[model samples]
Target: MVVNEEGDILLVKNPNRGWEFPGGYVDKEETLQHAATREVREESGIEIQVTDLVGVEQISSKRLNVFVFKGRPISGELSLSNETWDVGYFTRGESLSKIKLERYKERLLRCMDEQNTPFLLES
Candidate 1:
């Protein structure tokens, strides 16, 4: 997730997932951090400097593992890509209300607190 100076969280409205942080699968040629930065830029037109690893999520149903990161925007403006229907920054309360999926909400809540050690969630 990318947060601004005002502590607003950046979110993208995925057609399938509703509202969630900008992210996708890591490329085989890219590192985890590089993929995170690239996905944010591709999905939201925002260049970000990833600061920390928030957690890892294991989706048993899909046999996939998602690496979540916390970051701040280094530059670029918010714009939508084919992967995103909407892109914007929202306050903590607004973000929580905007995201409908429980797993997505959990990721956001976990990322908002930087003090927490990296976590692993399985579902």
Candidate 2:
């Protein structure tokens, strides 16, 4: 999750996933943090400096593993990519309503709360 100085969380609208944090599969020879930074830039046109790993989620059924990180925007303006229909920063409350999926919503909430961060979950 990337948060701006105003405390607005960054989000991207995906065709399949609606509104969610900007992310994608890690490329070969790329670190998880590097992938996160690249994905954010590609999807939202925002360069971010990742601060810490917020959580890790694995879904056995889908053979999917995701590393969620907390970050701050370093530069760039909000722009849309082919992968994302829209991108913008929103308040925490607005972000909750914009992100409809429970799994994604949970991640955002946990990342936003310092006490509940750095979590691990498998499903």
Candidate 3:
């Protein structure tokens, strides 16, 4: 999930779930990075670069592995698809309450931990 320069986190509302980050299962022969970028674009119509693999979530019931990646918006305007009912950026605190599921809210908070981002070295 990507946050803007103002520190607002991006969120997409799924029909089953309330508000969550844009993501889905990685397709066959497709790269994880590509999948992350594509999911965000398809759901929010925003281009983003996958910056880091922040965390991994396992859905025991579905036996699914969700790779949570942090990203930054590269380009494109906000647009919605059938996958998402709404798309927008929200403050860190707002996100805590805006998300319906408790675990989903935890995931958003975890991504906000900036230490996950590796610092680039400079000579």
lDDT of 1 by residue, 1-123 (tens): 888999899999999999999999888889999999999999999999999888988999999999988899999999999999999999999999999999889888787666775888888
Give the alpha carbon lDDT tens digit for every residue of 1-123 in model 3.
788888788999998998988988788999999989999999999999887788776667777777888889989999889999999999988888889898787677667767753322121
Candidate 3 local accuracy as lDDT?
0.83
TM-score of 1: 0.93
Q: What overall lDDT goes with each candidate model?
A: 0.91, 0.93, 0.83
lDDT of 1 at 110: 81
- Report the C-alpha lDDT of model 2 over 1-123, residue by residue, as the tens digit: 999999999999999999999999988999999999999999999999999899999999999998899899999999999999999999999999999999888888778778877888889
Model 2: residues with Cα > 4 Å off, grouped in runs = none
Clashing pairs in 1: none
CA RMSD, predictions in order: 1.3, 0.9, 6.0
The clash count for each model shown is 0, 0, 0
How high is each candidate's TM-score?
0.93, 0.96, 0.87
Predicted structure with the largest TM-score when compared to the true one = 2
